[model samples]
Target chain A: MEFQEAWPYVVGVYMSIWAVLLIYVIVLQNKLAAVKRELGSLSKAVERKG
Target chain B: MKKSSLILASAGALLLMAGVYLAFFVAPDTVVRIDDRELVQFSQKIFYFHVPVAETSFVFLVLGGLFGAMFLGTRKRSYEQMSYAAVEVGFIFVLLVMITGVLWTRAAWNVWWEWEPRLTTFLVLTLMYSGYFVLRSSVQEESAKARFGAIFSIIAAVNVPLTFVAGRLDSLKPVHPKVFTLQGASMEGPMLAAFLVSMFGMLLFATSLYIMRLDLLRAREDIEYLKEELEVG
Candidate 1:
């Protein structure tokens, strides 16, 4: 906390940045997994069609 | 594990480390105290690493925007990948500059942060890049996301130079831009070498990270494509 005198805004700023980046990465992961699941289901349907 | 990419990335890392060694250890420290109330350090040691990488970030930012524009124009996946890659690399380096710059500013100017034009512009540019990434992820449809991204990239690119120029000249009436050149000093020999090496290393680091991330993105795409193929059969 001593450093706060030197840098009042930095701790908050850093956390905000990482939080945003973390959210972005999580979203990407979620999307990728969902897409994979959809593709897997579609494949099973096509196997029946063939 | 492409041979050339790996080599470039490693070489960049090595040179950057060497530059760091020279900076903190080799270059002389300069303290510029303003009005006795605050001191600004115009040191030789920090400059070698600071200036080059800062300059390099601009280059990468422009490259990223250009690729983003091209991807929009051509609808090419590679261009989109390039745009993403360049921004990621640029963002990483810019983050370093901001961190280092803050320390220098505190030691020299007796302030941790200021609404200084350059710093403000850098912050804006960073936010813009983050927006680009956020836009990319917000959409699930590839073509639609790329289209919007391409447009955003073009707009962001158009603003990059304006933001930088405005930051520099934010004061001078018709000539409002601040003309604060490195009014500090010239760096020669070992100091310059260190700066150049660090710049090269940062660039290489960005490239390597881009390639690795890109490989993952492409692999994911490939898997998606295979799934579609199986479903249609």
Candidate 2:
């Protein structure tokens, strides 16, 4: 297959790979930050009680 | 994220980029020679990413099963968390595999999907593992949820190998390509290098994600425990 002929499929595959990975990493980062925030608040609550 | 997982993720990203470069520039385009003609398979470049993602998913799911077994044997919370994390990360890779695979199928076979042995078995494998999450969420008790999830993970892992071999089995008449056989891999030279680099990169990346998710699960558990203690006091 010539590059011209195969470009669509090749581009689609790479695009899907990177797009899915980028979305997943972004989601994971946001979830991690949220967890950290919750944990920090919980620690403060415990400290105040103590 | 932990320092170790961060380093792993960075290294994995670097290697994957190198793999892409090698796959495009260094690896020779696939060619087939007939008596009077040569055909170049440009779309075959997708192999560099597709196979690696599929293999990585298999590795994670297998690890998920192993962790599930450990949890069952020791009744440990950490093992259960690890198993869940592995499945979640593995599921992401599996989805990528399906997407890239569909593109490849269309390019090579002129069809988006075929109900062949490999494809059917793989679809079943995906659905079975997906049910693992649904099973966990449906259960109300922590211990019971973990136990059922562990058992499901083990059972699901069994399907992974079946999916892998479905194409090769004699009766199946599969259209899927078999890259590895008893003798050796079918690829060589720069092609093999690209594949190996991508494979290891994907494994490391998935491991980093698994560690990150596991840490989050542990933190959530700790938060729940502290909240319960605070309420009791």
Candidate 3:
């Protein structure tokens, strides 16, 4: 196959890896932040009740 | 994030970048000769990342099954959480492998997909794992959910080796290239170096993701327990 014909697949494979990693990391960060916030509130609730 | 996980992620990212550089700039292009004509296959570059991701997915799925079995034997909440996290991370890598594999297939085989043994078995593995999440959601009782999930995970893990060997079995007639066999890898020094670096990086990155997901699962469980305690108090 011609070099030009095959280069797009190489680029696509690399781009897919990068894209998936970026999206996964972002999702994890958001979930972590949300969990931390919930935990903080729960801790305060316990302290206030005690 | 945990310090260890962060360190692993950073190191993995760096190695992956280095692998990319080596793949493009250092490793020689793969050339195939047919009828006295040499063809340079630029698409073979995808092999470095595609195989690594596929192998890494296998590792995570196997770990998930091991953890699931441990959870069943000991009834440990931590093991259950670890199994769930590993499966989730494994699912992500499996999806990546499918995507990259399709692209490579298009480039190399001039087709989007084929029904060869390796690809067919891998597709089955992916679908089975996808059902894992659906099964997890469908069950109502917590204990039952965990029980069923663990059982399914173990069953699914058995397919991993089957998929790996499908390409190598003579009767299967798989078009998938077998780079590592009983003999050894078929590539040269620089190509091997690139593959090793990428493989390690992919494994570490998946590990980091697994750790993060495990922490999240535990946090959610803790919150549930705390909420129950508060309600009782």
Q: What is the lDDT of residue B23 in candidate 1?
A: 67
TM-score, first chain, each model = 0.76, 0.91, 0.91
Every model's DockQ: 0.11, 0.74, 0.78
Candidate 3 per-residue lDDT, tens place, A1-50, comes to 65889888898999999899879988997898799789889988977888
- Which runs of model 1 end up more than 4 angstroms from their true locations? A1-50, B31-44, B170-185
Q: Write the per-residue lDDT of candidate 1 for residues B84-152, one digit (tens) a residue.
A: 767776666677667767765664456777776667777787788789889889999988887787777
- What does each candidate score in C-alpha RMSD? 6.4, 1.3, 0.9
Per-residue alpha-carbon lDDT of model 2 for B36-135, expressed as tens digits? 7988889899999999999999999999999999999999899999999999999999899889988898888889999999989888988998899899
Q: Of the candidates shown, which would achieve the greatest lDDT relative to the real structure?
A: 3
Measured over the true interface residues after superposition, the C-alpha RMSD of each candidate is: 7.1, 1.2, 0.9
Clashes of each: 11, 1, 0
Q: After superposing candidate 2, which stretches have Cα over 4 Å from the reference?
A: none
Model 3 regions more than 4 Å off: none
- For model 2, the docking class works out as medium
What do the candidate models score in CA lDDT, each in turn? 0.64, 0.90, 0.92
DockQ of 2: 0.74
lDDT of 2 by residue, A1-50 (tens): 66778889998988888888878877888888898898889888888888
Residue pairs in clash, model 2: A1-B40
iRMS for model 2?
Answer: 1.2
